[model samples]
Target: MGGDQAPQMVVAGLRQAQKLHPNISFLLYGQEKLLSKLIPSDDPLRAITQIRHTDEVVTSETTVSTALRSLKKSSMRLAIQAVADGEAQGVVSAGNTGAYMALSKLTLRAIEGIDRPAIAALLPTVRGLCVVLDLGANVEATTENLVQFAFMGSLFARYVLGIEKPSVGLLNVGVEELKGHDKLKMAQLVLKNNPLIENFYGFIEGDDIAFGKTDVVVTDGFTGNIALKAIEGTAKLLSNFLKQEIQKSFLSKVGALLAKSAFSTVKHRLDPHRYNGAPFLGLKGIAVKSHGGTSAYGFSSAINVAVHLIENKVNERLAKDISLLSQHLVQEMENLSLAIEKPTPIKG
Candidate 1:
């Protein structure tokens, strides 16, 4: 309901997704009466799109527990339950992110060894796509959680992004080992010692995000969210600046016309619509959160992402990988603890 276009944009995206992938089906969860009014009566989509009506709508201000308690007839809860109940492969929404995340985690539950599910977003870089994890899912995280994020994110890059042995870098204030807070220092120690973590690059600063120095950058939600918003804001500002500069004079307008093709290419390269959705990783099922202001193209891109995740079995793969790594770490720590606890027999 908080989405800028709400049902209209969702319907538009659904139409485009059906055209792109005929095998994909949609279960619209909301006020069936309002959605019916928005969609054309004779549209063939009416057949493909199934509406699951709810008496109440989950709002942004609704608490997680409140939302769950009120799930007697709520659209978001129904949508999440669909995935958990095997009715739907995944769930995508442009509604309140907090509500969606809460409902999803509560219903589907987290995968084994996952402390908290993180939001992983793909950013296009000069080299290729770079995956950023913990993008506003958990504001504060522990060293163990950060290390686990690296493992899950590495899998995502390998399977979803098709990068074999993708490099993992710790997002920090500086690239030096001595830099960053205590949390990062602890995470670095674990990453360096973990044999399963491939291409464990030491550290990467904010500047390296767009430069694509590494395939995966791991950070807590607080820093990752700020960095993401900063990058997006800068992109928008630059785009606006270019447009204003190009429209200043007749000669510039002619020049713009001459450079239209090149500009279009650049726009496509930088446009967030091309990479609109982000996956909530570490969950038992695939759940994508689209931009609140997304258009048809953005939502379409989101659906494509969902399809990729489902096809790749990203959630299941992450769960398996994390489970193995977590168990190994637990055993290693236990052995170390026992060794330290034991006193030297004859030293005295």
Candidate 2:
């Protein structure tokens, strides 16, 4: 109900998602009358689905705090509430992100040993797919937060992307040791030392993201958000630039026509729809967020994400991994705190 396409696109996408994940059932949460129209009473999937209707919705314009306080009957709130109440295994939404995050955090809270949740999304790279985390979930990530992101991101890469030994990399200005902020420097030590974290590459620069230098890229929300936007903007610019250039000349147009299949493959590979869902990792319950402006196909992809997490028991995996790294997480936070509090001796 909150996405740009709202009930229409939501209904169509759910139908398409049913076709994709035939084994899994669905539960729609929105105005029953509107959603009922989208799924006829005779539809087979409808037989498996149940709608928990609510008149309210979390709009894009609504503030997160306001939505949290006022929106008791909102579709987004009810959907997440289902997950919290054990009625649903997971929840997916293409609604107001801030509201979704706030509501989810408030309702589900973070898993034990996890300070906060990081938004993790799969991205297509030159070599294959890469998973990036903290994409606008937490504006500032502490040392412990980044370390947790690394663990959660690696789990996602292995379970979802099927990378056998997913290499982890700290997103930094340089791959060298002495070049990052204190938080990154501290997080890097833990990542390198943690045995559960396999193939721990020390650090990676921005360009390495597209090359798939590592399977999972970890960073604070501010940098990750900027990088995500940059990747999106670059993809659009290149596609548009190539189309304009091809149209300028008859020979180029003919060449493009001949290579049309190749171009189509590239376009689809880079299409945002292919990788539309972002999971709020580290939460006790599974919650996925889709791009609000996405199309029906994109929404279907988001549903796919939720199904994957639920089937794979992603939260359970993350919890176990977090426990594995608990000692390291504790030690590192204490070390960093001490470093901050300790005073430097006067220079000679």
Give the deviation of candidate 2 from the true structure as CA RMSD. 2.9
Q: How accurate is candidate 1 locally (lDDT)?
A: 0.84
Taking all chains together, each candidate's TM-score versus the true structure is: 0.91, 0.93
lDDT tens readout by residue for model 2, 1-348: 468988788777888888988787777898899888878899876887897788888899999978899878888998898899999898889998889999999999999989989998889988899999999989999988998898999889888888889999999885354567877877877777778887899789999999989999999999999999999999889888998999999999999999999999988988898899999998889999989899889989998998888888888988887876888778766765676578621111
Top of the candidates by TM-score: 2
* Candidate 2 weakest ten by summed lDDT: 339-348
For model 1, how does the per-residue alpha-carbon lDDT over 1-348 read when each residue is reduced to its tens digit? 236787789889988988998888889999889888876668878878887777687776778777777656678778888999999999998878888898889889999888989898989788878999899889998877898889888988988889989999999876354587776766776687788886999788998989999999999999999999999999889988988998889999999999999999988887888788888888898889889898888898888888989999888777767877998777655554475469621111
Number of backbone-clashing residue pairs for each candidate, in the order shown = 0, 0
| Candidate 2 residue spans exceeding 4 A from truth | 175-178, 332-348
Pairs in steric clash, model 1: none
TM-score of candidate 1 against the unseen true structure: 0.91
Q: Give the total clashing residue pairs for model 1.
A: 0
What is the alpha-carbon lDDT of model 2 when measured against the actual structure? 0.87
